[model samples]
Target: MGDSNATMVTEFILVGMSNYPRAQMVMFVVFLIFYMATLFGNTLLIVLIILTPVLHTPMYFFLCNLSFLDMFYTTCSIPQLLVNCFFRRPTISYTRCLTEMYVGLFLGITECFLLAVMAYDRFAAICNPLRYNVIMSWKVCFQLAAMSWAGAFVLTLIPSQFQPTQFCGHNIINHFTCEIQALLKLACSDTRKMEMVLMINSVIDLAVPFSFILVTYGRIGQAVLRMHSAKGRGKAFSTCGSHLVVVSIFYGSAISMYLRPQGKTFSDHDKFVSLFYGVVTPMLNPLIYSLRNKDVKGAFWRLLGKKMSE
Candidate 1:
């Protein structure tokens, strides 16, 4: 019966950030700028890594995957957001909404696992420098990346399977994007089981990976402290700094958004938090990595020099 009722609701209205006419226009322009920056910044990192042979190591290889993920992550929702902001009430088809939800889940979960994989890479580099190359070889790196992609895609399917059957015809999603939590709010049926499922997924997706990263970094910290040379310690810190910053931004926003009490009232605050992780964080990652890492800067200059000579 619920499934039958869900079919009647063919579209959903997205109640975006601002109801005010002027604010909607302002937000559209602001998000347009953010979307453009996300594209340009992530693209630059990917191209620099690809064009520069010096960046062909495991660390940059993972960074390349991250850049590609960020590219699609933002693209999955921001363009729709930009389009919706222009209208008083923007509607998304049931199929399109489901696609957006699944795509976002796929990319978000993949990033969570990818960050944990990166933390392991750093641990190998700093804690066991002698064995870093052996442990993080091309084969191993490829396997880890593949696992992150495949694992996230499969895990995302569970939540998606629960979606179409649950949205039993309240078609107004009070958020800009078709986020899992936002869409869950519109469901007319019992959400306790679904929320429990999402919560379990969140724990596995966010907490477990975060705990792994923490343990990896803890060992890395001890190794860095034991280094007698200040130069060695500084190098280790520099190597890990960009990743640490990126992780903090990514996990901080995600945990805040997802790992909360299910009974808590949803608000416009949720929308802003989603925006931070979805748009702001993606745009910031490339800047954080490029500006903080000398290796990437040098690669950029070397690439530019070659381009100039041609």
Candidate 2:
């Protein structure tokens, strides 16, 4: 019976954006635009940071990592989503589904940790200006980045090892991607334990880091207020504000999706919420930083002039 069940569920039919059958083409165009923008924005930020020596601070280092992460995060599922819009009944093999779920989870968790580290970078810069360089030395920055990646891998890998390897029943995923919660709804085996594990992981990856960022920002706020120099205060607020905006958008949608009680069925609302972080946030990160940051803008013009001159 178990072997038969496993063999029966080889692929999952993705009921992605299919509810609005008439709007399929519109959804495809929209998603394709978002996907292209995410790729271009993130890749541009990464390249700009690399080519511009002036933007080589700890903040941009983390931003470059984040841009790379956002690119990968969207790539993990968006292309497939864009293609699925063209098909009447889009399907993904069970293996590919599981791979997407795990990879997305890893990237999501890494972003959680990376954002918190970026928050700390802001805290050090604003609250400890005198010690900022020493505190966020190249060695320390690399170590923090390494820890975020390694921590996410361990967090994602261990719990996933215990997840049900087989899924049965109607193999239909309502979400565009093999999201963890959506995938859990289709598990053949008892998922109470897995749900508990996921809950714990959510608290660790989402709750803890978010709380840390909040407290870090609070300290930064106080420090900025105490600064006597108007210019200093403005600079501090400008940089920290950009980071805070990114944090709010990414964490707000993620917490809404992952930290919620597991429901027996996924809804259209859930799919849209997933799109906000999975698609929108990645595209917005670079735009937010580049538009608001003078250093980035200056670097871009300088590089443009250099290239044109050559």
Q: Write candidate 1's Cα lDDT for 196-302 as tens digits.
A: 87899999999999999989999999999999999999988987888898889889989999898844345788788888788998999889989988889999888
lDDT of 1 at 65: 97
- The models' CA-based lDDT, in order, is 0.87, 0.91
The local distance difference test score of model 1 is: 0.87
- Candidate 2 lDDT tens digits, 1-310: 5646654578898996777889999999999999999999899899999999899999999999999999999999999998899888899998899899999999999999999999999999888879999999999999999999999999998778678766766689888888888888888777788888888999999999999999999899898888999999898888888888999999999999988877799999999998888999999999999998999999889988999999
Q: Which ten residues in a row have the lowest lDDT in candidate 2?
A: 1-10
The reply for model 1, stretches above 4 Å from the true place, is: 2-7, 164-168
Q: Report the C-alpha displacement of residue 100, candidate 1, in angstroms.
A: 0.2
For candidate 1, what is the TM-score? 0.95
- The C-alpha RMSD in Å for every predicted model, in order, reads 1.8, 1.4
